[model samples]
Structure formats: structure tokens, C-alpha cells
Target: MSAKVSPSPPLYTTFLVYCALQVAFVSFLFSYYDIEVGPIIQPVVKWVIEKAEEIPLVKRTFELLRTLVIGDEVNEENTKTLKKSTPKQKEATVEVHPLDADLSYLPVFSSEQLSFFDGSRPSKDVCLALLGRVYNVQKGHKHYAPGGGYHFFAGRDATRAFVTGDFTEAGLIDDVSGLSHQDILGIQEWSNFYEKEYKLVGLLQGTYYDAEGHLTERMREVIGLIEDAKLWKAAQTKEAEVFPPCNSEWHKDSGGRVWCTTKSGGIHREWAGVPRKLFNPGTKTSRCACVKNFGPPLSNYADVDEEGTRGDLDNPNLREYPGCSPTSNSCKLQED
Candidate 1:
């Protein structure tokens, strides 16, 4: 006899039965054990959705359904969200100004205007000018105010007097004409000191700066002189290293004495040289220097082929003391 086959249930009916069983199992856990299944299943469902989004067909299908249900608002919100998440490029801006523009943002003061701040006026601040730059010296009112020791320096550009030690009206002038390069360098140092110690107020409209607060031709010349002075000072330092100065001591009753040592003139070296008078070029002044007695001169060390056994003792710039021997390391100074 032929057996009759039973028809299978529909797929939708099977799915519904499986979902109902899962719901019953979750409800039993929640009621009997006080456990919730939503928290554990939520992350898993979200991960599955994220993975499905990677598939183009699934992603497009979901997007189409979402658009039909939410309309254009969702698309506009997504576009705005995308814009917020992305970085934007900044626009470039360029500004042009004249060469003599007031770039320092400091005020320009005339000599007459600067004179008001000399501590004479009770309402004004104590101020002074150096190298065309004005500095407020109110903090040092004791020294810059009226009847003070440095009162003459207030309210004026006394650049020349800083090095010359001349506090007279004629000497306190800003005119630094005919001053030596060393004097210019000294003025520069004083300017640096004021800049570091006090607050810069403005530019002085005088020899160093114009009415517009720009550097003038005289200021440029002074700067050039300062540069030359710097070079000269550097060369002098190098010469001192090569030929160290002698140690000297003076007494009222006893005579003065100058001697040489390996550590003289704050220069520590291996050689204890003999004393000699080193005359500065184009100047009548001279200083005692220690002369090396052996090997090539320190300045000529790079000349490999240059033969010298007497060291710097034979240098033309050096001369022995009148009463001292050529090889002596010490000399007793004779008072003229």
C-alpha cells in the first residue's frame, strides 16, 4: 500500500514559532532569575546590522526603506552631520604695508613731547630716551626723578653722555657725531640695558629715528659703527687668547710690578710666557702681555710650513721693558 505524505508548515509559520519560543525563554529568565536578555542581545544585533551595512545590496535596500519612511529630513540631517564631522580649510589672508609703517605699535614722540615725561610733571611718568627709544623709568623714580643722581638722563636722549660720563647740557645732547666706534658700541650697550630693565614707551623723533618712528640715516651710521666696534672687540679677545695679559700689582710706597704665568689674565694655558709691552695699533696706549718663548705663534698655527722657534717673542707689536731682560717673565715698572 502507498503511504500518504504530510504537507510541511509554511516558512512564515515556522519563523513565528521560533520567535515565540525565544520570547518565552527570555521571559522565564527575567521572572525566575531576575536576568535581562536585552542588554546582551542589543550589542550583538547592532554588530550584525553594522556588518550588513557593508554589503551594497543590503545597505541600498535599507536606505531606500529609510528614505520612504523618513522623507528628505533624514538626508538633510545626514548631510549636516557629515559636514560637522569633516574638517574645513581656512582661507588665506595677506596684508601689505609701507616700508616705514608703524609696525612696532609704539607711539612717536617729539623731543618737546618727551620732555614732559621727565618726572618734572607730577602726573607724568619718569621716562628717558636712549638711541631713539624711549623707556619708562617710573620704577626707578628715586634715581630718575627730580633731584636724583641720574635726573639729567630723564626726558632726553643722552646717548653720548652714557659713554663719555659727561652730564652737562652740551654733553647730554643726542648728537653722537665724531664719536669713536667704541663709544657707539658703549651707547648700544646702554640702550640694551634700558630695554631689559625698563618698559619701552615709544620712539624718540630725533637723530636716531624719524617723525614716523623709522630708523634714520644717522641711526644706520651708528649701527654700522657699532658693528665695526664689535669686530674690533672680537679681534682683541682673540689676540688676548693668543697673547694673554700679564698680572700686575701697584703700591704707593713700593714700585709697580708685572709678571707672567700660565694662568695670567684669566687665561689658563700650558705655557708661562715672558712679559712684554703690547702697543695697540694707531693708539699711544699699551698693555702688558705675556709672550710665548717656544713653538710657532698661536695666530700662525694654521701655517704648517712657517718655521718659528722663538714663538711670539719676535712679533713687531711687542717690546721688552727697558730694565727687564728679554727672557724674564717678570718686570718692575718704573714710574715716569
Candidate 2:
């Protein structure tokens, strides 16, 4: 028997045919969609396909499919990626806060237990703690992989470093309240990235969150401040977006006629922001004037508008002044 031992059988033809059909379907989707499935969905398809690697036949099927579809292109984006919105600058991102997570069926991990997830321990899972939440990043092996670029973050609630970009041991602590508003906002993008790219494992134990997972008083206060800052920033953005500064173009013709425009509701239309003393050949009475959008507002910046009509030399009154006329060549709208 040893002399005439036969090799293991090959994959059955029927199974290979089934695998071919499955791969063909994926290939068709790649060809039809042109590989531009937006951010949230394509990662899921890629992750699903990656699981096939555990089975050699299925892996072969995917390789065959990828070869037929992509033509052997080696792309780095196929695996790990990182996008950083600078620490000192705020990223214009808004998503549900990390505390609002829905972790109904995940195991709670203590600070000590987090060490088990670094791939150094026998545990087969890779995870990280961020902003009191744990995310299983086992799938993103290239970055979270053992001795990977982001390996320092593993087995730690390095929330501070996520905001500060300091991946050293000193920054690998739970104290993130000292971070600036912009830094916190920047970290939020990472939070959203993890939320989208990985599965939520559980919550982390620390000062901000009590052992019972309840928000501490300090945490509540800090969160309240963060929320207030977020609201204020949003209000400022909406104010700029909805009500822009008024600009009046001085016109000498038609006996002191002018046009004023302000960006309101996102349309460049007519606006009445001040009283213009027109000759009014028929009535001969001063009246409030409306003007079409001649150009961008006189008060270009929001800060300049906030200082509105006040005597601040840094941001002087740009609204139509009481005595502005065509002869003066200083006819600009100032809020009376």
C-alpha cells in the first residue's frame, strides 16, 4: 500500500463549477458597477470576499474571479488605509457620539482585559478601545495586525493619542478631556471610521465611565461641554449658510440708486437691507431700497458680520450708513 499510495483527490468538478458560477456573479457586479460602490457598501463586499481565503478552493475561486475582473492589479487600498483630519483642525463630520452606541450583545472588557486582545495573548481576536468603546479590528489585519503600523494602539484605550497623534505610551491613556475641541472633532472621524469598518466589541473601563458603565460626573460635564461646543459650531455654520452678510453696490446713475444683496436661502436674488434716499422722480420721497446680487457680501467673513454695525475698527459697520449717497461714493448698506 505504501508503494502504490494515491494522492488526495482534487476538488470535485461540480463544486468547481459552483465556485465558478459564484465568482462569475461577483465579477459581473465588479464589471457593471465599475468598482465605485460608495464608501459604506464596498467595504462590506470586500470583507465578505476576504473570508473565502480560509477555504483554499474558495480562495482559488476568488483569485480566478479577481484575475478575470481586475487583471492582476496590486493595489494598497485593497487592504488597509488611514485618513487623518489634522489634530489642530476640525473635520466637518457629524455622527452619533460614541456613548450613544448600541452594544446589547457584547462582552464587557476591563482595562486589564484589554491586554488580551493585542494578539500577544493566546486570544485569536484583535481589538482596540477608543472613547469608552471597544471595536473588533481583526479583519483589518494589515494595520491592526501584530507588529503592524497601528499595533501600538492595540490592547489600549489610546483615545488621547487618537486625537493628539502621539502613539507613544504616554498618550495611550484614557484621559482625553485635555484635548482641544478641534482635536476631539478630528478623533470623531476615527470613531466613525471604526464604527463603519469594524464590529463593536464592548465598552472600556476607566475614569470617564464607572465600572458599572455609567457616566461619571466628570464625564457628564465634559460631554455636556462637548455637546455645547458642537451645537455652537453647528449654529455658526448654519448662520453663515442661511444668513450671509449684506453687500450694497453703490450706483451713481438714476439719482442715487443702489443694489444690495445678501446670501439668503442660497439664492442670489433681490434683498432690502437698508433705506436708500432715491430721487423718486414721481414721489420724491426716501424709501427702503432693494438690490440685486451685485457681488459677494460687503462683510465677507462671519466674524465681521457678528461685530455688525458696531464701532469696532477691526470689523467696522459695513451695513448701509444713514448718510450714504451716490455723490459720497460710500453708499453701503448698514443695519439701521
Candidate 3:
């Protein structure tokens, strides 16, 4: 038999197919970000390419995307000015005029220009951003200044970095929408720190916000996540204070008794008696005392002793359960 031959696709058809795939691939990459900006980018990119076609290849939109996509730091000052062109926009604006005169002077910053203020250029004013807002840390020049401890965060949107404690290149990205509840609370702590120590400047302009300062779903998620984190912390604190972990020591021959910060009567690991903290109102003393068979206590065992376990907590007990550690256990509760 003669050798079989296969026909190749037309030259234009092959080019067109690849061209469509290229467009789809670019769109897919951009889909990871705010889809609202897709239309804007397309037109703007078309215009840019037309204008700069004769210019160097490095100046093209594809090159910019390549740089941003490959994690090549997008640290340049985004010179393009952003504005709230929409009059009827109902989105949250990054405007804050605190009643306190001290905090009222902070200026607003769009995401584009955030790097300029990141304390790197000592010649320029020092600033730091959190929760899509900027702050003037000029007062704490020593800490935020060049060579300062946080200088690594000087040229970026470091929202995720603050929560994850990853100040290195890996954790320095601003999009922290994917963090867990605990991480969100971490961000809240940093936010509180900045609010108290530094003066608020203004809101940032990207990721959680648009050019017009309109907040996005990612920003709303952060807000809710922060609230959830705080609530979770508070619930954990109350749990530790009220029903502390039971700490016990075993003697092998005798049953080891366990006591918790709750001061509820010592619990016999083998016994099922409902343990209650014996509280003496007159002496303000409390101790954990168990009633026989987990029933009501009789008059003789009612002498309660309580000094309030707020300051003095039994963390050895906490370490046993690990649930009652509540932030950190006291030094006395742990041995070297």
C-alpha cells in the first residue's frame, strides 16, 4: 500500500486558533483578580499597544502582566491617577475624619501610590498601610524608617503579611482574602496597633478597593472575618476563665487530684461527682470541691474560697487539656 498523507490546517486558521487561545489564557489569568476591571483593561491595553507598538517590547501590556504574574514585584509608583468618577456609586469610601484632632490629619492613599509612602525613601514621608488604609508613621520614624524593623514592608501592600507574620517576599502580598479566621484576627491586632500608635492616613485603592474607592467583596469578607476572629478569641477567653482545664498529678498508688483555674472543686479523674467551685462570699475565696455522686453539696462542704483566678491561673492544668491555655499560660503554671 502507498504511504498515507494528512493535510495541515490553513496558515491563517492556525494563527487565528493560537490567537484565540492566547486571549483566553490572558483572560483566565486576569480572572483571578477583580473581574470588574476586565473591560477597562482590554480597552486600555489595546490603546496602549497601538500607541507603543514601535516602542520597546518591555513597555507593552503583556510585559506588565508577565511581570505581575511571575511574582516579579510590582513595586513601581502607579503614576496613573485614580478617581471616583461615578456620582451615584454606593460603595464604601475610604474617607475618615475622626473627631480626635490628632488622628484627623491622616491623608487617604490609593493602592497605586502606596509604595511611595512605605518608609523606604527617608527623603519622603514614612507610611504604612493596613486593612486597605494608609497611616502616617512619621511619628515613629525610628521604627518605620529605613533600616527599621519593618523596613521589609516598606514597598508593598502588606495586609496578608501582617496577619501571617510572613514579612518576606512570599507573604508580602496585599490580597489576604483567603486567610483563616485566626489569621484575620491577627490582622485585626495589627490594625489596632496601627490605629493606636500611628495616625491614620487614608484608604488603599486596590484588591479590596477600586480606583473610585469602592469596597469589594474581598474587603467585606475581611471585615466579617475580623469580627468572627474577635468573637472567637473572646469566646475562648471566657471558656478558659469559666471552665478551665483540669491539671492532675499521678502517684500510681493513690488517685491524683486535678484542679483547674475555674477553682471548681478538685476533680478525681476516676470519680464522676459533679465538680463545683466552693465559693465563700464572706472571705471571697473559692476552691474546686466535688459533691458525692455529682449531687448538690451539703452545708459542711459549702465553705467556698475564691480569690479570683484572673491574675493567678493554673496553666499546668491548661497544658494538660491544651484547650484552656487561653493565649499564654503563666510562668508559675509551667516548669523549665
Which scores greater on TM-score, model 1 or model 2?
A: 1
lDDT of 2 by residue, 222-331 (tens): 66767766876786455433333333344455334344444432435344333233222333444333322223343344354443442222222223446565323235
Q: Candidate 3 residues 203-273, lDDT tens each? A: 66766655555666777777777777788788655543444434455565553444433343232233332
Q: Which ten residues in a row have the lowest lDDT in candidate 1?
A: 92-101
Which portions of model 1 miss their true places by more than 4 Å? 1-105, 300-305
Q: Who wins the lDDT comparison?
A: 1
Go through the candidates in order and give each one's C-alpha lDDT.
Answer: 0.78, 0.59, 0.54
| Candidate that scores best on TM-score | 1
Q: Residue 147: error of model 2 in Å?
A: 2.5
Please give the lDDT score for candidate 1. Answer: 0.78
Question: What TM-score, computed on C-alpha atoms, does each candidate reach?
Answer: 0.65, 0.44, 0.44
Clash-forming residue pairs, model 1: none
